[model samples]
Target: MSDQEASQTSGVIKKFLYVNRRAPHGSNYAQEGLEVALIGAAFEQDVAMAYIDDGVFQLKTDQDTSEIGTKNFSPTYRALGDYDVKKIYVERESLEKRGLTQDDLMPLVYEDEDDDWEEKPMINLVTAAELQDIIEQSDVVLNF
Candidate 1:
């Protein structure tokens, strides 16, 4: 069904939070979580994603998986905005512990349809405390 049709049949719009705590490679948790988040967004749900622990590595730029024989799915993250999946949260402590900064991540942005199609960022670098509040506010939390 289309997003509008799904929304109409679902009644209440739920806030879905997909939490990622795994690295981008090695396993499928990160990729599977991303697919689920996009699916939720396609259903017209309020979907957001949080990256903690090694999950922060999923967004880090300049990733090369050639040696591992794994496809680099990092570029797919850039399409989250197209699915209307904004509100991506990255834990501050995770970045610090990894010695990485926002500059090391891909620049993900979305066009605000209600604001004359103005482009805006989707990534929100938040602290552990703020992330906790976000988790509490979510109606559904899926971890990977």
Candidate 2:
């Protein structure tokens, strides 16, 4: 293999997990984090995103970006699929606290549930245990 092939190989990770624990549009943290996820996805990285606590706010409905005086990047969440990085998972308890159900979330908020709605329900929430599994399955982890 050439040096270029070796460099590309070195950049790949088995899995890359990012834990987003902040609200969208509060600062640039959430925005930058999502950028990282998208970049990883574009690079063909096995990227996964987890919403913990306030991170659920990122999936909130009908954002008022005009008042915030910034471009609304909220809709970009749905575009992750274009980059093949839609392995989105949320915490069950966080949903309950936010009074939000999977159905309540917007179209962008993707939960990795089976497509067969009849054969399997579409709740893609993971308990704290499963969150641990997410971490364990990841070869590289980022906390944002």
Candidate 3:
């Protein structure tokens, strides 16, 4: 059997890439995407999440949804690390067009056992081309 086929039969982890392309709270897509990511992570798969276009706004800090009659779920992103879902990639171009920087995003960090349990940033800044490469390497890609 081929390497990938053999790996699948051996129950090796599969790489799952979730692409988020919508503005958070404008509709249900962003929230649904996050839900899907959480579900996939729960399966113990290798999950990688990419935020592109308006989806980059989902990580913006200090989001207040109370005025819109919605519960602010932005903080949930911070909890993703607890679920072991930490490979978050934000497209640099998308952030630039939105006039956002890494500082504008919520500080998502995880406890690193390899680093003596020190916390490290979960979000990764990536170029559009790099995101594309990631998509290509994934076993499955879910676009939102």
The numbered model that scores best in lDDT is: 1
RMSD of 1: 1.7
The TM-score between candidate 1 and the true structure equals 0.93
Task: Encode model 2's per-residue lDDT on 49-132: one tens digit a residue.
Answer: 889888988877787799869878988877776666667788988889988887666665343435642232222589878998
Q: In model 2, where do residues sit more than 4 Å from their true spots?
A: 1-7, 10-13, 109-123
Q: How many pairs of residues in model 1 come into backbone collision?
A: 0
For residues 49-131, write the lDDT of model 3, one tens digit per residue. Answer: 89999999999999988889976888889888887887999999999999999999999998887889899899999999998
What is candidate 2's TM-score against the reference? 0.80
What is the lDDT of every predicted structure here?
Answer: 0.91, 0.76, 0.87
Query: Which 10 successive residues of model 3 have the least lDDT summed?
Result: 1-10
- What overall lDDT, based on C-alpha atoms, would model 3 receive against the true structure? 0.87
Candidate closest to the true structure, highest TM-score: 1
Q: What's the TM-score of every candidate structure? A: 0.93, 0.80, 0.89
lDDT per residue (tens digit) for residues 1-144 in model 1: 476677575767888899999999999998888888777775778888999999999999988999999889889999999999878999999999999999998999999999998989989999999999999999999999
- Model 2 CA RMSD to the hidden true structure, in angstroms: 4.8
Backbone clash pairs for candidate 1 read none
Tell me the deviation in Å of residue 17 in model 3: 0.8
